[model samples]
Target: MSDQIILTTSSHLEGYRVTEHLDIVSAECVFGMNVFKDMFAGIRDIFGGRNKSSQNALRDARTSCLEELRKEAREKGANAVIGVDLDYSEISGGGKSMLFLVATGTAVKVEKV
Candidate 1:
């Protein structure tokens, strides 16, 4: 394996064969929504503009989660991650809401097929 870890959404990489199946690794990121973003949610359509606030939040969370996932896999002696999954959830209460991102995968050791 190289210095960088290989990550794939599929169960296996085409050119590589699994030699050891490590433990399942996961990472989470929580993104908070400001009042302004929520209040202007409906007005965005009137101005015919994209929801930059939401987009930024999603992008940031996704990046954080994936990076953390890679770190977790690497720590467990895994050269690659297979069967990756990303899940998003909304947690709201008391008129406030936050976006939660979770990334999970099976850490594995792989070699050339």
Candidate 2:
């Protein structure tokens, strides 16, 4: 992770001016649900309550995706990423379920305004 890189969902950053528009960068992560978690989540679904397991998985995935995004931006010589977006999806195949998280943003060089 690059501490110098700023990440934001907004298109504009306060106290910074975009000097150059680099390119769009994206990162994706996939997490597989274990059998025990699936069972507990199913139970929680039936009870109509929050599923901590799934929530934690998503949180970790988002964090990892953001880290990857920051790395990509740094590699591109970008000091900030704006217009960031996150997407989540689930895939079920071969009797298994997996969660996918994708983060995208426009890498840009920014200077203090």
Candidate 3:
């Protein structure tokens, strides 16, 4: 991670001004749930309990997606990313359940006010 790179969900960062607009950047991650975990999750869902396995998988995917977004922003010479958004979806095909996570933001150069 680049120390200079700032990420925020807001459209603007406090105490900093956007000096240049680079481009829109995005990163995506996909992971699958194993059969055992899927079975456990299904049971948990039926019983109406929190699915720790599913939650952990989502957390890991989100982390990876954010890291990729940071790398992209740094490569584009962006000091900050604003207006960030995250999306999560389930992709099931061929009897396999997969999770997809995507992070997106506008890369920009910001100067401290």
Candidate 4:
């Protein structure tokens, strides 16, 4: 069911016509920056270089959020989700940091045009 669902950032999917608009669906996924990773990131900021760990963490969060969004759309009897949007933010204080990710889209029923 997961693989059968289509997701798009555009308002509509090409070659597919929206027959019924279900409802909006969203999912959230969060990741915390451990002290070890935070230390490495700080060092990278001083050295001015790429941060592979940070990038990977962000990518992983996105994947998880989208996957859950897909599941929600499926449960709503939607074959696809259009106008997909992904948002990310950071929360930090007291020597601890976390990354929050939210994936949202409009669930719809679609068929080949």
Candidate 5:
């Protein structure tokens, strides 16, 4: 633990949580399943209609990725994860889609004698 950390004095949360803005100190990873979703999207595009299946799959992927990030944060001894950001994209030339979830915040350890 560093002296600059405010929460270091108290034996409470390891770090502060800011839902509106997640701090940037660590890495951001992604997890998603879009192989089948993309295929449906392409089919819907040809018919000029909405691709509900693809959209739902993307949403599911985003949720799953976020959960994974939360678990990682917990393992890293983080009290809470803030400033979470999510994104979805379709890879070019590959019939695959990607769901990215970014969770960022400070990881701190309590100072003890």
Candidate 6:
């Protein structure tokens, strides 16, 4: 697993075993500009209130990140991803926000194992 496969088929599992033995790789990956957004988010928070802009920004970023992961998985010939995880962080000094949508799973050709 290369930490960039978006699973969309399996509900009980993150990955679907299609082959006996094979390694999954992340062929493509995409992410949103988090640093800049985080900074602004922090500023908004300091005002003793929540900023809807910041919330919206994070949501958009997450969506974009996931889309990228799915595309990468498709390119790698993976039907689903396992052990999917999402990580978010703020830049130092609250300068920006970073969203990392990572997915990991085994890629294999389907057959009787």
* Shift in Å, residue 102, candidate 4: 0.6
lDDT tens string, model 3, 1-113? Answer: 34768999999999999999999999988877574366575664544566666666677788889999999999999989999999988888898887778899999999889
The candidate maximizing lDDT is 1
Q: Candidate 1 at 25: error in angstroms?
A: 0.6
Clashing residue pairs in candidate 3 are none
lDDT of 2 by residue, 1-113 (tens): 24578999999999989999999999998877674366574664444576666666677788899999999999999989999999988888898988788999999998887
lDDT of each: 0.86, 0.85, 0.84, 0.85, 0.47, 0.51
In model 3, the Cα lDDT at residue 38 comes to 62
Sum up the clashes in candidate 6: 12
Residue 88 in candidate 1, Cα distance off native in Å:
0.3
Q: What does candidate 2 score on TM?
A: 0.84
Q: Tell me the tens digit of each residue's lDDT in model 6 across 41-81.
A: 56645455666666676677767766765676666666554
Poorest stretch of ten by lDDT in candidate 2? 39-48
What TM-score, over all chains together, does every model reach? 0.83, 0.84, 0.83, 0.84, 0.47, 0.49
The list of candidate 5 runs beyond 4 A from truth reads 1-49, 93-113
lDDT (tens digit, per residue) of candidate 5 on 10-68: 22443443332223333355544545555665674544465666666657665566566
The clash numbers for all candidates, in the given order, read 0, 0, 0, 0, 2, 12
Q: Tell me which of candidates 1 and 2 scores higher on TM-score.
A: 2
lDDT of 6 at 16: 38
| lDDT minimum window of 10 residues, candidate 4 | 39-48
- Per-residue error at 36 for model 1, in Å? 7.8
